[model samples]
Target: MKLLLFDFDGTLADTLPICIASFQEAFLQVDGVEWSEEEIEDILGPPETEILRTYTKHGDPEEAVECFYETYASLHPKVTADPAILEMLSALREAGFFLGIITGKARRGLDYSLRQLNMEGVVDWTIAGDETERAKPDPECVDRALQQFRTSKEETMILGDTDADIGAGQNAGITACAVNWLPGFTPKPLTLTPDAVFRSPEELRFWLYRQENPLDG
Candidate 1:
């Protein structure tokens, strides 16, 4: 593939704990409601505004959104980047593939994560949640990335760990590769059928390298 688009939260970085914590903290502070673990997981993959709308009791979710973001920013320092994934990104960049990020995270959160993870040059482009009218599960974000990369659908692949990610990729007419690489987290439906699934970063790296040199394999 000429271009590789990636998802942020679970696929590239391990931020599930921070995300869950910040989400719950925000709701509790704004709506005075406590969400169970299941409740939090069910609404994950969408934009913060969408998630807040689903659970917020107030007239507007703006305060809750602000609280969530502030909490997430403070907790973001605890999130860590996967070394193997970072290595794969470097390898893919060196191999001449245009890399981009299409994530549900807002620009501020995405930028903070990227800066903290020190992945400034790894991705050629990025389309965060606030940048697009619609988030993942809709093709808008991926479409935006495709336009930025100036690549065709057939020459692009989307790699992520959620059904929404795969669905967004497929919606954008690209290959969707799922990665079950998050440690200590298991998605509810284990049987999500994407175009491809990689269990680990090493396996994903191998597959990406193979894509770069198909004849060698």
Candidate 2:
């Protein structure tokens, strides 16, 4: 079966605001530091430790990580998916595709969001940043999903909204698509250009089915 590997934050759900707020809360509560919006957005896609380090002049990385989780967990469900995203995902699942997540979010954070969105059943697997030895931009999670389904990268596609997602797909040797969910919000392309760029899920839907059935493509 063709595998569709998705990135959680910024892709499936709109958790960027809560994530930035949680990190800032951690920084303020733990170290009396505050980050500008630009700073927060700049560090959103990397590991939690990296985001913490960027906000700190001198502080314990472990402490910041703990605080981040604590604050984020308390703020779960504050953000949600686009109205049609879950339906689109369901259609893809029923279309004979294996659906999974590869995200920089922690397991607890990802789980909470998935549960609130009532999507735990549709997703087959999720590899959180802390769940594996390596995270996105490294592609180990994507490869892991490929292995789980006994499929090859040739039969896989990674859809995400950031550069790290593109890097992960490149690392795994799979086709990648850069999804621009927020129109007029321009960010630099991932270091690698994706096979396609889509502005909406409907656009991605057509592209995915085409990729899934190459003869029909």
Candidate 3:
């Protein structure tokens, strides 16, 4: 593929732990409620602001959002991207592939993670959850990226860690690839199977290399 779109949280970086911790802390601080990791994952498709607005009971949603950001930033240093993922991204970029991110995170959170993980300037474009009228499983974000990159669906692929990411890619008529490299991640049953499923970053890198260099394979 000439253009690659990646999902951020569980795919590019191992930020799910910190994300869960941040949400739990935000809710506990704001609403005096302790949310389980499953509870947080159940409501993960939308932006954190929307989640806080919809789920916070005893406090102002805006305040909860702020608290979430504060907690997230505090916990961010504990998470880091796998070196192999960084290597794969760099290789793809150097090979003339346009790399982008299509994430359920808001722009602020995405930017923060990029900076913390030392991934700034790695992606050519990004479409955050709040940037689109609808979240994943809707094609709006993917469509926008395709438009911006001027790449056809046949020349692009979307790699992610969850079914929503696959659905988004499918809805946008692009190849959908799934990776389950992050430990302890158990995604719900996919409504549609992905075009390919990879077990690790290295596996994915090799697969993409084959796709790009069929003669080498």
Candidate 1, superposed: residue stretches over 4 Å from native: none
lDDT (CA) per prediction:
0.82, 0.78, 0.88
Encode model 2's per-residue lDDT on 102-214: one tens digit a residue. 88876777787788767787777788877778767888888889889998878898999887899889888889888877433444556677889888879988876665578
Query: Of the candidates numbered 1 and 3, which has the greater TM-score value?
Result: 3
Error of 1 at 186 (Å): 3.2
Q: Each model's number of backbone clashes? A: 0, 0, 0
lDDT of 3 by residue, 1-217 (tens): 8899999998888887888888999999989999998888888999888888999999988899999999999888888778878888888899799999999998999999999889999889988888889999898888999899999999999999888999999999999998887666655656679999988777877888898789993
Clashes of 1: 0
Candidate 1 lDDT over residue span 118-202, tens digit each: 8777889888887788777899988888888899999999988888888898888999998878776565553457988888878
TM-score of 1: 0.90
The global Cα lDDT (0 to 1) of model 1 is: 0.82
Top candidate when judged by lDDT against the true structure? 3
Q: Which stretches of candidate 3 lie over 4 Å from their true place?
A: 183-191
Which ten residues in a row are the worst by lDDT in model 3? 182-191
Q: Candidate 2: which stretches are off by over 4 Å?
A: 49-63, 182-191, 212-217
Model 3 lDDT at residue 132: 88
C-alpha lDDT of candidate 2 relative to the true structure: 0.78
